[model samples]
Each structure stands twice: as structure tokens, then as C-alpha cells.
Target: MMREVLTFRGKATAGTEFALGVAAAVVVLLLWEVVARLEFVAPQFLPPPSKVIAALWTMATTQHLLWHSLISSLRVWVAFLIAAAMAIPIGILMSSYRIVGAPLEPMIDFIRYLPVPALVPLSIIWFGVGEETKIFLLWLGTFFQLVLLVADDMRRVPHEYVEIAFTLGARPRQVMTDVALRSMGPNLVDNLRITLGWCWTYLVIAEIVAADSGLGFVIWSARRYVKTPEVMAGVVVIGLIGLITDQLLRALHRRMFRYL
Candidate 1:
């Protein structure tokens, strides 16, 4: 196993990979517990795993942790779905016609580079710090990036495939749908998976201001009172959720694109 892991470009079995990942996590947590016990860093600042777990239990039982998790998950999924719905078509349009892409690409490039957190004030003003504002922030963080990725995926579809379609008497629309979209299937899924992760990263920023619920709110509230254990627990919950979400997406990707 050591030799396999040491070998560059060597493929590990799925079970081996899963074992390695679990082992690494356990090792890190053990080290953290040891360090905290030794007071290398103040426990208040860096709570041990046991404290974090205890805090997590308290939150789940009394602080409505599950409710917060559900709300946060809903916000992320809703925004992500909306972003995907809009971005896929826009990206396809941009890639399908140079006339459509020429003007839009530069604007998307500019907007995507603009800091998401900096847009919080504008989002709040436009959407009134309601659920809309939170959703909009998550969407803003995802859409511009995903659209560009989708467009690039479309562009990467081989010209030979398009040429073949055309030679076979396929219409423009048919060529796009049959050739380009079909060819970029794996890449499109990969891009969506990546952009979904980005959406999660913006969750705290989305829920930072005017938020009374969700894991982000819990974390922020705990921080204000210096409740490090609760704060860490909230953060850990987010990390766990993200890890699960990512793994699910990876499973979907593998199941959908087995040939790749």
C-alpha cells in the first residue's frame, strides 16, 4: 500500500482510496486532540474534537442545528439550480454563435472578477436582505463562473464532430444539440460539480449579514460571543455537509459517465 501510494500516477482501488482518506482524517483529528490537550494553542481558540462534538450535540439537541443545516442546504440547492438553468442556455448560446459570444464574454469576465463579498451591499439593497438576497448572493457567486466553464466546455467539443454533423445534413440546432452538447457531457458535469463547491464557499458570506438562521448564522453568532466550541462545531458541520455533497456529486459523475 505504501509503495502504491508512493508511485506517481499509480491507480489505487476505490476501497484503498476511501481507507486512505478516512485514515488521514482520523490522524488529523487525533493530532488536533493531542495538541489541544498539550495547550500548544489555547483550547478556547482551537477547541479539541471532543469539545466540538459535545458542542455539536448541544446544538443538535437545543440550538436546532438540523433546522439550520436544512435551511442552508435549501438555499444552496435553490440558488445552484437557478444558476445552472440560466447558465447552461446562455453558455450554449455564446458558444453556438460568435455574434452572441463576442459581446457577452467580456462582460461576464468583468463581473466574475468583481469580488462577491463586495457585492453584498448591492444585493441587500436590491433584494432587501430577505431570502432573495441570500439566494442572489449564492447565484452571483456561481452563475458567472459556471457559464464561462460551460462555454469553454462547448468550445472544447471537437470541430471534427461538428463538421461531421454538418456533412451528414444536420441543421445548426441539431449539430449543437447532437454534437457539441453530447460531446461535452463529462466536462459539463465536472464543471457543475466544481461550481457547486464554489457556491458553498460563498455560503458564509451570503448568510453573514441579516441572517438569523443557517450554519453561517450560528457560526457568526458564536464568534460574536467568543463561543469557540460552538463556532468550530458549526464550521465542522458545514465541512461535513460539503464533503458529503461533493462525494454524492462525484458518485453521480462516475455513474453517469462510466465510459470516461
Candidate 2:
């Protein structure tokens, strides 16, 4: 009977927490609706939540804007995945070999600071204002940061782990694969979560440089036509998508690292 009471109390606490979160969201939405309807702020500049939702519904029915936004997001995801594939291995290799890392360090630092959007003209020149150029820009934006992150994580692994592996008659490859890599896994996953946020900003910047279609393009094109509601809708979509992706990554991390 005591145990049952404790369980009931625990559930009640969780329910209270959930209720508070829902109430907070509702209050914010109500405030926004009230302010917009009262014209306390310009509706054109700050459309109410209802207007944004209406715009989304109308756009969904009339145009493939959402489809285009998804395509743009997919491009960013694919490019980021490719960048990670290339960066992680190279980072591991660099961390394992001091000499290799030394020579590349300066060059990597230089390029990492360079603004990716500044390469738009050159990218178009090379890849010709197509999807390839956009993807390449996204890759360039994400690759250096990931490389640095992975390499840094690899370096932070305790030397004792490597020593233990060696004492157990493990080869260098075995030490890296079994000990160093596993140690770095959590940090790498965390960096990926952080990078997912960066990818949203990079995708918009990339699309702005050269794109006939995309969420960024939608926002940009809508601004030109003075479609403030559409622009607000696009902004909302971007935020929702970014939040969804972040949640998914968080879930993946929790699932994979449950033991940790």
C-alpha cells in the first residue's frame, strides 16, 4: 500500500509538470492573438499565430511550398551527413598521428573561419548555380567544425584506456577501434546535436545565395511580393522543422547511450 501511494504521487507530479508546459504555451498563444487583434503591434510585421496557421493551411492547399521546404531541408541533411562521414574518419586519423595533424592544423583553422556564403560566387562559377553548388556550400559550412569537434573529442579520451588496451596485447588499430573510438562516441553524438542546429542556419544562407526553390527562397520571394503572412509562415515552418530534428537526435542519443 505504501509503494502504491508513492507511485501515485510520482504520476501526479509528472502530470502537473506536463500541465504547466501546456498552460504556458496556451498563454503565449493567447497573448499573441490578443495583441495582434488589438493592433498593439503591426500585424504585417508580426502576424498572429492564427494568421500564420491560416497562411500555412492556404499555402498547403494552393502550392507545393511545403514540398519545396522539405527538399531544401533534405539537401542540408544529406550534405551534413556526407560532411560527417568524411570528417569523422579524417579526424580520427589526425588525432592518432601528431605529425599529420600538425601540418593540417594551420590550414584547417584558416578555412574554418572563412564565411561559407562568401564562396557563393565561386561556388556558382564551379558548380553552376545548381543543387550541387548548394550542397557543396552546406558541406563546406559544416565539415570543418565537425572535423575539429571529432578530433578534439578523440584527443580527450584517457590515455589509460589506450594503455590498458595495449597491455592486453591489443594492436594500435585495436586500441583505436575498441577504446579510443568508444570513448569519443558520446562527445561525437553531442557535437552532432549541436551541428544539427547549425545546419538550419547554414541551409537558409546557402539557399539565399542561389536557389530557385527552398524555404529560404520562399521567404525571400515572399518578401519581394510583400506577402508578410507567407514569410511568417515560412519562418514558423523552419523553426518547427529544426525543433523536430533536434528532438529526434536527442531521442536517438538517449536510446543509444541508455547504458551510459
Candidate 3:
């Protein structure tokens, strides 16, 4: 007889999963609150959840926090899309042809290792420290790594699959378009999702140089005034925004790869 997947994990509903995730977050917050209340850590250094919420509420009502958050989110998405557009085609080209991959891989890797922050001056000179510089910073952080990720995913497709396609009289173009790209679609989506997180990581760095708006700007400004609660609030906003986008991507990935 075949065994049934009847364990707790196997039997979990979406509601149960959501509840568990919420519970885990609640537990962490409770612990942090306890520490803050007991004065285990200084309030100035580690504000409690209530204080952070109050700070965030003040910003929302008085300082246009939503607009700044939206600007930051737009920057992230624009940069991520640009990076994906540049990286995916090149990744496919490199993975498809050893002649192409061998020569260019070294140059790309070399540039990737040069820290993004080091490029801030160059980007400011080139793009004039406006939106372009910020977006470029976000792109630089994500593109090189994403190209490698997509290429690696493509290369991971089994040679046997390609051979099987060829045996069935599939043309090179058809094999690449129908088989290779399709096989890698789910993985590519996952790659985009992962790299989106990387794009968010660059936000503070991007906005710090000449920014007047963005969550990063808010956090940086709060820090200047020693507004620990406001800084924490801004950090929490970034985390929540990231969490939402991450989950959205994961949901889209699951929808795209349901057969898997």
C-alpha cells in the first residue's frame, strides 16, 4: 500500500500556515516588548513596538510618510525591472553558447566584485545624483548577481532533456525557445523574487547621498536628530514593505509553477 502524507505539515491549511507565521512574529514582538519594558536595553537604543508605532503614526499624519514610502518602492521596482531586462537576455546568451560565456564571464565577475558603494561617486558624476544615480545604485547591486543566478539556473537544466528534444527532431531555435526557456521559467521567476530583496537592500545607500525623499531619507534624517523611535519606525516600514512584495512574488511564482 502507498503511504499517505498525513503528518502535521502535510495536513496544514493555508489558514493554519498564516496563523503560525503571525504567531511567530507576535512572539518576537512580545519578547522585544518585554526587554524594552524591563529596561534590559536602553529605550533610546531599542524602542518598544508601541513607541515605534507612535513615531510611524506621527510621520504618516504630519510628514507624508506614505509618499516617501511610495517613492522608495517605485525606485526599487524600476531598478529591479531594469536589471532583469539587462540580465536575463545576457544570461540566456551566455548559458546558450560556451564561446560567448567563456570570454565575457570574467569581465562581468570582475565588475561584480567591485563594491557598489565605491561606484557612488562615479554614478553621481555620470547621472548627477538625481533619480538616475539612485536607480543605478540599485541596479548595480542586483544585476551582476542576478545574471549569474539566471545563467546558473539555465546551465542546471539536464543535458539529457536537450538530447531528448533533439532526438524528437526539434530545431535549435525550437529547443531553446520551447524547452530551455520554458524549463527555466519557474526558476527565473524565483530568481527575480530573490533579487528583488537584494534591490531593497540598496535603498538606504542609494538615498543617502543626495536624497530628499524616501524611507531611507526618513531613517537617515531621524538618526541625525537621535530620534531612535522614528528610525526604528522607518526600518519597520521598509521591512513590512519588503515582506509584502516578497510574499507577492512568492505567490506569483507558485501560480506560475503549479505543475511543479
Leading candidate by lDDT: 1
lDDT of 3: 0.90
Instruction: Compute each candidate's TM-score over C-alphas.
Output: 0.95, 0.91, 0.90
Judge candidate 3 at residue 92 and give its lDDT: 88
lDDT of 1 by residue, 1-260 (tens): 78887899988889899999999999999999999989999878988899999999999999899999999999999999999999999998898889999999999999999999999999888989789999999999999999999999999999999999999999998998888888999999989988988888898988888699998999999999999999999988998998898899999999998898
For residues 1-260, write the lDDT of model 3, one tens digit per residue.
01223564466667777787898989999998899989888889988888899999999999999999999999999999999999998998898899879998998899889888899999999999699999999999999999998898889888888889999999999988888988889889988998999888898888987699999999999999899999999999999998898898899888888899
Evaluate residue 166 in candidate 1 and report its C-alpha lDDT on the 0 to 100 scale: 98
Best of the two (1, 2) by lDDT: 1
Output the lDDT of residue 164, model 1.
96
Residue pairs with clashing backbones, model 1: none
True-vs-predicted CA distance for residue 256, candidate 3, Å:
1.0
lDDT (tens digit, per residue) of candidate 2 on 231-257: 999888898888888899889988888
lDDT (CA) for every model shown? 0.93, 0.86, 0.90
Give the Cα error of residue 93 in candidate 2, in Å: 1.4
Q: Which stretches of candidate 2 lie over 4 Å from their true place?
A: 1-17
Q: What's model 2's TM-score?
A: 0.91
Put the candidates in lDDT order, highest first: 1, 3, 2
Could you tell me the lDDT of residue 248 within candidate 3? Answer: 89
